[model samples]
Target: MQSVSEEIKIRPIFNTQGVCVINSVLYTGYECTLFGTNSQNEIVEQLELESEIVKIFPVYDKVLISTITGKVYVYNPAERNNKLQCVFTNSVIKSIDLDGEAIVLGTADGSVILSDVQGYGETFNKKMDGMITLVKFISLSSIKRRYNSKNKLVAVGDAMGTVTLFNTTGEVVYREKNCHSGQIMFIGELGNKILSCGMDALLIEHSLESEMTIRNISENIDETIGACSLVGDRLFMCSKDLVITLSADLKIVAKKRLNIPDINGFDVFGECCVITTDEHDIVLASVVQDTLVVDKVLIGDNDEITDLLVMENMVVVGTNSRYIRTICKSDIERQNENGLIRNKAFSGELVKSNNEECVLSMCGSNKVFYTGSKDGIISKFEVVTGNIRDSVRAVKSVSAEAPITAMCLYQDLLITGTEYGIINGWKIGDTLELVFTASASSSEITGIVVNNKKIHCTSKTKEIIVVNLNGGMDSSISGHKKGMWSISEHCQMLLTGSSDKTARLWKGDINSTLQHNTSVVKTLLTERAITATSDGVLRVWNTTTYKELGAIRITEIKDERIWAIKRYAGTEYIVSAGPSIVIIKDSSWEVEKMKEQMQKEEYIAKQHAIIFMKKGEYVSAAVEYYKLNLERDLKDALKRITGEMDISPLMSVVLLDSYKFVKRVSKWARSPYLFTITQRILQTAIENRIEISAKEADDLSKTLLRTAELFNAAY
Candidate 1:
């Protein structure tokens, strides 16, 4: 599988419905798209469907996807075919599960459908009360072999909080009504008991023999249960801000408070869990000492950004909220230095406005900055350099009859545009003094630029009004077929972005209209003219030639809109803001090349290790696999090392701590020869008097005794 290139790094800008992890690949569904990511959080595959994705089922080597349009398709990533095979179509599929080739689908209309993947196979359909929310095929053959009865069972949960267990012939084996107050979210089988967690924040355990509730758990959970998964003998239930781990007997093992307030989806893989938040951040967490610690956070912004201003060493971000964030360039660089796997949070300083309304526009020059709010209030702020850090303080406030929409600094004047098509120029000193006022347009003014002592502004009426600084000599220029959103000026060139999905550059009468795939929302000018579109792409165009240079996709969510783009003044870095801020450096191409080289080298080394294994050079192959952190391959190679003479080299390769070594080999206790060899290694380590903690030694000793019992029982 081809991984995502290093030239592009995705910081999530929106939440997904759910996440699934299988074979080390994470699958997530958002709107009409399904994305698959590898262990490194890089996009490996993206499948765009016709409708919104509803549910995903991992069936051995293939994946079955259900959409809101009631279509079911099967995809096999291991195969060469990229097209999904449509198997069935019915009412909106809410959940699905598979046992071998038998497929079970639960629909939103409270119907259960059982069929095979070929579509023409013998099918059975049954209807129940309320919408069917969850479905699973559980086997109880091993625990009930003495009954001499059918073991394949189908468990279904409905929106009315009813759970029903059925046999293959459509016979209802057991039924429980009103198991929860709200919709059922999850259903799982634990030995002879059935586990069900519901949106009512309740986890219920039901006995198969008695057909009654064995236990009901609602402690330490205040929010609705969103999802649940089974790992080993433990059950993991997740709410919006909490996760509870329970033993097989329904006893709470650990309760962890995940600080994320808006969790959209989460999935547990091995000892770690991945959480996707509505704030567009992907949080990676793991249990350490019974506490869930956030190991890394893929940072994203919280709200829609309104404007961005580039200053000396900081980038000021104005959001739709009544607050502006100041991000230091040095802080961003420092976070980037923590390696790709570490946390990437932009810990910026937040400055709140006195106004209760949202910010609409912003402009700054040197240490002084101004912000215009939706309530016709404009606040002036100055940067206060303190002993430790820089802060912003409000200096003065001014108001107009209408909301301020755009602002720009020209010479010694601060020119502002209002929603009522009014323009005013003010001189900045200890206080603001209005010098000139003009009626600019017929509609709300969206953008403003001052060039050659002339004030030019564009409005929602698709007209650009140009006037002198004295508010005289006003002339209207036909701007675009649609409303213009942004405007920029560099020397004699004028650039304007419009809702007509085009950016136009005008130098005198000669103008060039650059067509884009989506509506242009913002335009910026550096050495090149850059236009940001609603499709999350920033396209760069040569100003003089009006030729397209390249395009960068700033976000994965299509049509998310790029609100603002600015050149980090006097640098090759470009800062773009939307739901999050992204800074792209000029050396990205070289960095991409270096990363490609590293991946190639790793692949080559893996190939060499495989060759060594095939050639019976187990010691060399083990070393190479250890270096690559391929634990499975390293263990397999170590198992091949036989005879007492090879013990020295084997000990050198298995350089793990005493506890970890026992834990590793305990998983393979069924293999008699390997277990014997591992026993010899442990004895040698004890003879060497390797230092170990008392807790670790006790745990190691218990694990070894269990492994020995299993080995003897198997033999």
Candidate 2:
């Protein structure tokens, strides 16, 4: 419910995996963990391949990845305790098959080779018309009326729809054409039936008993069947939009939509589906749920982060040569590293660490840190040990499509700042739980805080906004008022010191008016009227009725001026930090009676604007104060006070009506999209006024667009 503070970091996972989801299972050969999804999904905890993976095979606890170079990288989930890694295969291990001690390899140029794990290798090259696309083992019932392992046949589907079947003994059994109308996509077996589906747009049901192709499926399908598998009675096929779960007869039982873009890899485990998107985001969700939740987002920084450290009594922060930084915990920062400086802030002599890459970070606790760099490498930093560890964990998050700016720790959560000026947060752990976050219109967040289930953030626009932990914004308080020299808050009262030589009491919400000077509030003629309460008195106020009020008489100086006052405990003391300093005699009084008088405005409204014309009284009350250098001259302050003495003080009500209208427009953005038209009035005003800079106008345009997005999302 709390708003996400301005500074947080995040990555887009939609670009990595193309339609096929990535499944982040343990991998071998990369020397790093990979977070990949099953099909076209992005893989979580998967390693980014130094080379492109052309093919993959998931066998029980091991996943095999093959590249065009003929080498195979094997990842054993059991051996590494399900950690992602890369295992090298000396030879370009192309297509592989497990046949007891012998391994079959399909060469790049239409040749079949044989090899053994014990170093024996042989070239089983045979004359072929075309290159092999896929190899599968199948069994057909024979005269013996029994199907066993040795009797099983291997089916090789070529790029040109040619189907060649070979017995386990390497003898050609059956060769056929017209088997598929077009190029065959793949062929798999279910029971005694041979299922073939591909660009021909059909699932051919081949019968073992008839030794012929049976039914050609051409029903209830929108797109071409992509990756498919079967376990027991269920047949699963992935289409462009949805994953269809079918029974043995090809009857649709359950269908789930694959809505998000760029799914790289995907896998089904029991009732849940684990998927990775091209965006390097990992999600594990139930088939029944319409919206899937991201389990974890791998932190992938394509830069080289050199130095890292945990700060004392604060969150872990790291630095890189590119001036990129992050705050993280020690343990998480140690997941992947290439060895560098200590992961902590320097003491005494400050030296910038020489890191080569732009740093992206995720923090654990207040002292553990993790940083990712531009070279697709990650480093982990441990503050307590003062050491950097090599890749212990793999995070595949990316930011190439967009730049990530701010990142932080909200309690135990992760907050990230985006280039779009959006703030997003998620709970940090093995599971990424969604936390509340927000944006400051088109403003970027520079600081954030969380407490009492409320998130408070400060933005580049100089606004402080409060929102719920779930991102419901409560209030946005504007920091500065136009034309006011300085405005600040102390205790609960809003104080405004203006160039008009007046210090006015503002309601905490910038409402209400002070009563003492009905028309002319705290304006003074000497150009010096800023009030504060410290010790026992605040000078330059009506000391007649306020509690612990005070006045000062600077006999040595020429003009009476009050710059600042500080209230510590219950006493008021004044300090002159500006150009003209003044020493004064104590003139103080209690403010209780003054507070009582402020509650009743009619009693102080005895000034009649119609009948009695009082010249000096009204004009003197609204006096303007300009701070003149005491060291040079008191002539200006002195001359102005005497000259304005005979003038009648006039009161002007503060202009808040325009701000009120803007506030209404902001509220309108939340419920309707009509704020765009409502803002036409603001455009007219800008056209009448001299716009600041072209850049400022562009920024305002973006702010308006962001406001539109915010409002649109609300509905």
Each candidate structure's TM-score, on Cα atoms with residue i matched to residue i, is 0.53, 0.36
In TM-score terms, candidate 1 sits at 0.53
TM-score of 2: 0.36
Which lDDT values do the candidates have, in the order given?
A: 0.72, 0.41
- Off-target runs (Cα >4 Å) in candidate 1 are 1-18, 30-34, 47-52, 98-103, 113-125, 137-152, 189-193, 208-223, 231-235, 244-261, 276-284, 294-484, 489-521, 531-562, 568-715
Model 1: weakest 10-residue lDDT segment is 1-10
lDDT of 1 at 502: 92
Q: Candidate 2, which segments miss by more than 4 Å at Cα? A: 1-25, 28-53, 56-63, 73-108, 113-131, 139-149, 181-183, 207-211, 214-219, 262-715
Per-residue lDDT tens digits for candidate 1, residues 213-304, read 64555556776777676766677777766878877777788988665545655556677677665554556777664446776554434466
Q: Which lDDT tens digits does candidate 2 get at residues 1-715?
A: 1111111112112222211222333222222223332221112334565665555555434566665455566655446455434443543333455555555555345655444533355534343455565566564465114434444566666556667666555656566655766555556677656777654556776554467654544455565554455545566665544566667776668776644323334555555555543323334545433233333332222122222233442232233333322223332223223342211111111111223445533334434444434432233343443344221222323332223344445566665554445566666565445465566446534334454455554444434556666667688655333223223343344444332333455344554322221111112112123242212122454322222243433212233222323221123222221111122222222344455565454233323321122443322222221011121122222222343243222111101244443443344333224454435434544554533456655655666777778876886
Best by lDDT: 1
